[model samples]
Target: MAMMQKTEILIIGAGVIGICAAYYLTEKGYKVTVVDKGEVCSGCSYGNVGVAVPSICGTLASPGIISKSLKWLLDPESPFYIKPRFNRDLIGWLWEFQRACNEPQMRRGLSILHEFNTASVELFKDLAAQEKMDFGFVQKGLLVVFKSLPGFKEGVQEAELRQKIGIEAEIIRGSELRSFAPHLRSGLAGGIYYRRDAHLDPYKFVRRLAEKTRKKGAQILTSTEVIGFEIFGKAIKTVETTRGDFTADEVVLAAGAWSSEMSRYLGLKLPIQAAKGYSITYRLPENYLEMPVSLSETKVFITPLADTLRLGGTLELAGMDLSINKRRVNAILKTVPEYIDINIENLKLIEIWRGLRPCTPDGLPFLGRCRAINNFIVAAGHAMEGISLGPVTGQLVAQVIGNEKPSVDLSLMSIERFN
Candidate 1:
């Protein structure tokens, strides 16, 4: 083993959260070190739709989500599919998720997520302006188009609920929706426009953020897998990796889907499971969308980034498996032409990306410090909002380490909530 090197702060997982933590800590003059098992943005951070949705900051474990999942269970191409497996964690996660599907929990989650995403969007704009980074950060808003009347009514109700909570949500019904956005196909019923939402190229944002952090004097070690840890009574003394041993005054676990396993090293239980999702990117044709849109019934997200278009959706709970499900990808592809006019035959594929989103059962991320470890802080389990909420999570992680009061309350994000 190489001689044990020390850092002021060491962060595991060089995804968006970990890299963002490094950025903030480095800006604060802390000697930070970031380690990742793969290249930067190689996980869930890369293939996401790159949407910054503040209006629809609702929890995944909503009241009707379980029933909806049941309907989708038989359909392999459904937007949400959970494999009928016999795993202890999956069963436990589903049970806990079901328990949290009440009005009270969903309301609490909406309030918390609203605050996080709102702050995150402002931070993203500020960072882009100050850093002069052009990641196609556009604030043109998001449109959720529904084809069925029942779906449109439900969507309108949801939009009204969001409106009541101070979000700018407007309904465009019937022919008004078609006239408002002529690019949409003829069969669309209506749509909800969220003016507060924004988007960017997630790949560029994460990679550039990593580059900026490295330039700010943070040490980034890629392909360095963390195998074990040396723990004292209430702190992590050393982080043992495949490369070498390293000690840090403070440590952060932001390994996303792998966080559950990483917590075991410190005798902590983090209830996070890998919720796999897929995205297919293609070179945009003429008259492509200027902004991002969501297919309400199909639950597929279509985003335009520069000259390319990306379509992504589906939540497949199949443990830590990284395999791509062709059915799910086809589901996304097939759902696009139903809403938008596209030439399916002439479409050229850029890449098919599949990633594991670290999801907590209650549809809330596990942030803040662990009760078992003094120097360790967790910043994982943001689920679908991992890309959207990256900046604020990083800012809060730094505040936690600096012994400063956090910008947002951490009670709801505690890792010990399961206990």
Candidate 2:
């Protein structure tokens, strides 16, 4: 090892969550060091839809999700899929997922997510207002367009649920749907417009925040993969990495999809599964959308960033696999033209990105400190909401490490919840 580097706090993972944690820790005057296996924002945070939607307060394991998943399994281009696997963790995760697929659990998860996302959006506004920071943050709201009557009905019910939770959801029907977004196709049943939602370039946000953290004297070690850990008693004394070894007073496991695998080295079993999602970015079309829109039935999201447009969707429970499925990508592209009046195939291509989002069984993230390890904390498993919840999660992690009470109640997001 190269002389055993030392710091007050060591955060593994340079994605949005980890970078935000470093940012807040540095602001708190803590000597923080962040190490990642790849470059900053090189994972799930890079190619996500980048929408912070508080109106989407539903859990992934909703009442009808199992049936829906089963139906989607038959279609190769379905929005959701679970590869048949004999893994013990996958089996256990499904069992927990099944248990959580109830109204009570879904409502409880939604309440927490609503709080997290709402608070994070405010934090995002604060970050955006900072001088020398511009990540294309825009609060133009989002629209969920439905093509089928059945899907529109379900969307109305979801909007009602969101209203009950204090979220503003406006239903635009008939000609109003096209009036809301003139570029949309005419056959749309309706759309639910969420005025509180916002979108940004996720990669820009993370990298910009990382730059600000560096300027604040925080150390960020890229291309440094964690190999193992030296646990003494109940605390991690040293983190062994590919480059060398390092010791810190506190360690955060924010390795996104890889957090579960990393936790095993510390003798903790985090019930987090890697959900693979794909995104296709293209050069901004002449008739670009003013706001992000979701295809309700197809589960695809179309977001227009600064100079490019991104179409992203699908949830594949393929266990850390990063391979891109051409059929699934094609399905997303094909579904876009059904709602929007745009020729996707002719658009200039930017990139096709695939990332593994860390997802927990109950559709909740694993936050807060670990029970077994005194100095270890977890901040992973945000799944699709990683960008939405990044800032708040980082602030909460800083609060926990600083021995201050967390702003939001983290009991529901306990790292040992599955246990």
Candidate 3:
């Protein structure tokens, strides 16, 4: 261990949340340092569907989650499949998820998500423009298409719930949906359109944000592992990292999938499991420059990037592991045929990535001061929303350190909810 250095605020996990936190804090005139174990933005924050979906306010464990599991459990390639791994934590997490899937819990969970996500949408747009970051942000919105009429009807009902909360949703017929973005194959039923949501190139988004933060004088130290923390009387004294020991007035734990281990080191019991997801990008064949679209029936998200069509979707409830499962990757490829007539055999796979989504039992992130210790705050367990919620999470973190009002009510997302 090296000798101790000092910072006004220290952030672990240099992904979107950590980077964003550093940016906001530094603007508030605080000395900040950000550290990460691996390459920055290589986690789930970098490679998701890339949708800032304020419209998707439902909990990960919804009313039909238990019922849906029955049909998906047998299919290895199902959207929500659980492996037969004999892991106690994974089993316990599933149980916790089931408990939260009740009717009342669904309403409560989605309501909370709605507020945070909506606030994040506005915040992210503001940051991108003011910071001059070209994150490929387009407010063209997302169109979810389906092949089954029943699925379309159900999706409309779900969109109705979003509209009730002031989210704009246009229930379009198959022809109308395709007309607005004519790229998918035929036989598409109707789907709900969330005009308020937006999408972006996640890779560009993170990189540009980090670049802008660095320009604004936020030091992002990559490959710096936080070995352990120093706490005294409910305040974080120092964070011991591989590079050096740094003392700070406050610290934010934004380590994503690796957050569970960090929480254990801090003596906090945060039940977060690493759910792995895979994405494959294919170069555009021709004239596919339309807005990104998601296939509702297959749970596949195909977003159009600057020069390629990136198709990614699949949630594997694995541990803190990163071994790429060939089957899961293939499952994502299988959805391509259902959506569009891509040149599958000839298309090049620009990348094959597997990042862990730091998932909680109820699909809500823990964001607040650690009750056990005041100086230690948590901003992890974001799961699939790490990128989408990064800006808002960062702003809220700065607010806490500044002793200001938060943008949204964080009662449900508080770390105390776990206790």
Candidate 4:
């Protein structure tokens, strides 16, 4: 066996969570090493609708989503679809997800998510200001446009609920919608404007952060796949990877959708499922979208990047597959012309990307120490909010490793919450 390399802190998975954790830990003067099966930000962190929305408090497991998912199941082009499978884990997760849809659980999940998202967005702003890492971060806010009265009514109710919970939201209708967002197509019923929301170029953000971390003396080993771990008593003593064995005083598992498989080495059952999503980037049109807009009725998010525009939506519960679904892509493309003055046929495709988001049954991320392994921390399960919550998750990981109190309550993020 080759002699194991050593570091003060070792992070698995070089996606948003792992990279952010590495950056923060390196800043804290820790000898950090980040290893991933693929290159940095090459996974779910890239190619997402880069909207930094802190005003969204509702979980994906919220009420009505189950019914919505059922209706979507029959349509291949639906915004959310679940492949029929006999996997026990998927079955268990669905049941728990269904149970978590009630008022009490939704409120509890939203409370934690709301606080984390608010703090994370501020942290992102601070990172941009302090580091001058320009990833086209914009704070122009997000517009959720509804074409039908029913959807518009739901938007109003959601806006009111968000307002009650200290989130900045406003309902814009008719003339105001036209004047405020002249870029949008005519005949929209109404829309909800979340003033606290923002958008950015996610690809640039992740690559830049990785570069910055390397400059600060953090070791990032891409294509280094972790295969096993050496556990002693209640702690991980060493991690065995395809490259070589490595030893770290502290280990963090932020492997996103792959964490469930990795956790087995430590005798842990992490109830995480891979929710597949797709995004298509196009060269900016002559009249590109001025800001981030979510087609509320279709569930597609249109985000304006520097030189391109991205349209992304759809959540498929079809375990770790990167294959593109043309129907889902078409569904997203079809929604564009209804809300805006863009013809899908005329757009030039820059890229088509698909990624699997790590999702927990309850819609809350698993953050903090593992019960079976004292030195190991799990920070996966952010689902669609990985980019939005990256920095704060990193900050929390650093605080946990430094033996300092976390900025927010860690009870909700407990790894053993399912147990």
Candidate 5:
């Protein structure tokens, strides 16, 4: 018979969400074990643009998304592209996404998402301060630079919606904007500046976080695959893995893109879909950069690390496959030179990677315990905003374990919303 070693809790996936949950749970004295099919901090959590952007509460599918999506469908090299494939799941997910973009749906999404993201940023600050992790985090603020008056007006509307939810942002145009990032090309018009927003070197951020989590008495398991679940009535009794079988009093399904397949064992089919994203990093000039920024019009993000510069952003609705589309990668790289004078010729491509963002139909993550099961909580499907929501997601998991009220209300993000 296999030795059934019992743990207080078992968390699947070693991504930021999982690690954050482990950090908080262990702090509260829970005997927790986190299992991943692969290495810790080596998944989608690694490849994000690394923004602490609370103001991006407005989802990708917004007021004009239907028309914009139609336009995007026709263009191959657009910022957000949906590659045509005969996969039923992928096609079905797209339809659900379209359905989730209506006015009432988007309004609900913004309300829930903004609250979650704002809480997350605060949690991040507290943990980073206590942990003393140097991840090149800058609270200097974020600027959404635009190249035309129409785009600037659109930026203002976004800022306005963000303001309605208490996100501190302002519309800046002309000389005020030019003075901020003087290197911007002469063809620029204006932008929106979210004063509360922040950025970090994403790769270094995740690497340091994982290392810090491990040093703080949490186990870091790499190259381990969670094969199946050991369900005992309403509770998960064990987490079956390729390496070994271990019992768990509770489990959190923070498995990112793999949550749908993994959740099936529990008789729950999470409508989570994998939205693939790409990013590339290049060398920063020795004596350069006024401030790290994201080009709003181009949808390209640049984060200034301690020494290197990370540029990332590009969403493709392709299924779960690790194959890199060099064409798509090139499509992202083409935008950098349009906004500012950066030496792309001299800088070598330090890294190029893809991550699958676990997306839900309504663009809100499924958080807290489900009505269908007990002791099997879920906290995945943040899509492009996982990094922005990691800390709070973890805190919420810990609160649920402690049987306390979560700092933020998650009723709107309940898994039953889909059902």
Candidate 6:
């Protein structure tokens, strides 16, 4: 028999989402306990680019993405790939994703994401300003550079869409682009600058925030994996974990990539697919970049932290696998020289990381209370926007649990929307 503990609120997963949720919930005077399968920030939160950009509007399910993905399917080193599999969930997710690959759905998702990101950016600014909370937060904005004319054209169109949605985007070309990003290679098409974007060291941010949450009377139990849930009449009665059993008044599932599997314990089907992403970190070279840069054509993002520079991108739907694919990693590495004038041959390699990003069919997160389970709330499926929108997602989760109106309208992010 497992020993049982009680808490006012229980949060699963100690990544950015769960830790942020714990931060806000503790702030709201809720007795919170957060548990994770591993140490805090040990998952995707540890190695992401850590960019918080409001200018990112287009989602993975945007129009023409199907065609682009079809083309990428032939190449093993493409930026996006869905591993060949005969799984029913993948098929169902693909079907829904196909339906969402249209103009209207994309626009709707873009609007929601922009709103979430904008609010989260403000929260990040606040968090960075707090005493003893330093995570290398920099608001120098982001530059999306294009090496090809076609890619630049599409980038401009994206800028136009962002402009129409009230996000500030400036399109620069030739000498102007070169001057804006002096480190770029010559003969590049141009770049678009999003002034509202910012970045930080993701690992430092998550770890520091976890420490702060712990100091705020929240119990953070790492190395505790949730194995099963005892549901009693629409409420989770006991959350059985490797450590023991925990009974809370409310439960939150912010387990990132594992949320789908965990939800099955509750007899709920969450249409979240774990999309694997890779990142390589290296020692910061001399005269390093001040702001993050996105290689528009290659889909890679370069972020310079305090002492390290990171190159990260690529989305592979390979289902929870953390194995690094050299071809895909090389695909990201080989594109750096083509876009930037940097010579990475001499740069000291640090670490190569792979993480599974939880993705929904429509590219938006599932972030609300379940209709059938009153005490159950989900804050997962953030896809690539988890870092960008983590704080806002946490605040909203707390609001929902407190029976307060969510700051952002979560109608589209319904937990049971796919049902």
Candidate 3 per-residue lDDT, tens place, 294-313, comes to 78877888887778777888
Comparing 1 and 6 by lDDT, which wins?
A: 6
TM-score of each candidate structure, all chains considered together: 0.99, 0.99, 0.96, 0.98, 0.94, 0.99
Can you give the lDDT of residue 378 in candidate 5? 93
Write down the RMSD of candidate 4 (Cα, Å). Answer: 1.1
Per-residue lDDT tens digits for candidate 4, residues 81-168, read 8889899989988888888898788877777888898898898889899888998998898999999988999889878877888898
Clashing pairs in 5: 37-224, 37-225, 38-223
Q: What is the C-alpha lDDT of each candidate?
A: 0.91, 0.92, 0.81, 0.88, 0.79, 0.92
Question: Each model's number of backbone clashes?
Answer: 0, 0, 0, 0, 3, 0
CA displacement after TM-score superposition, residue 383 of candidate 2 (Å):
0.9
Per-residue CA lDDT of model 2 for 1-419, tens digit only, reads 37999999999999999999999999999999999999998989989989997877557899988898899999999999999989999999999999999998998888889999999999999998864689988999999999998989998998898899899999999578877799999978999999999999999999999999999999999999999999999899999999899999999989999999999988789989998989999999986777999998999999999989999999999998899899998989989989999987789999999999898999999989887899999999998899999999999999999889899998888888888
Worst 10 residues of 1 by lDDT: 174-183
Whose lDDT is higher: candidate 2's or candidate 3's? 2
Cα shift from native, residue 352, model 4 (Å): 0.8
Q: Tens digits of per-residue lDDT for model 6 on 43-139? A: 9888999898788645799888999999999999899999998999999999999999999998898888999899998998888887468999899
Between prediction 2 and prediction 4, the one with superior lDDT is: 2
lDDT of 1 by residue, 1-419 (tens): 57998998999999999999999999999999999999999989988999997887778999988788899999999999888879888888888999999988898899889999999999999889988888889999999999999999999988887777799988998688877778789878899999899999999999998998899899999999999999988889999999999999999999999999998877788889898999999899888768899998988999998899999999999888998889789888888888888866698899999999999999889889878888999999999999889999999999999989999998899889987
Cα lDDT tens digits for candidate 5, 239-288: 77887887777788899989988888778878888888888877677666
Evaluate model 3: give its lDDT.
0.81
Cα TM-score of candidate 6? 0.99
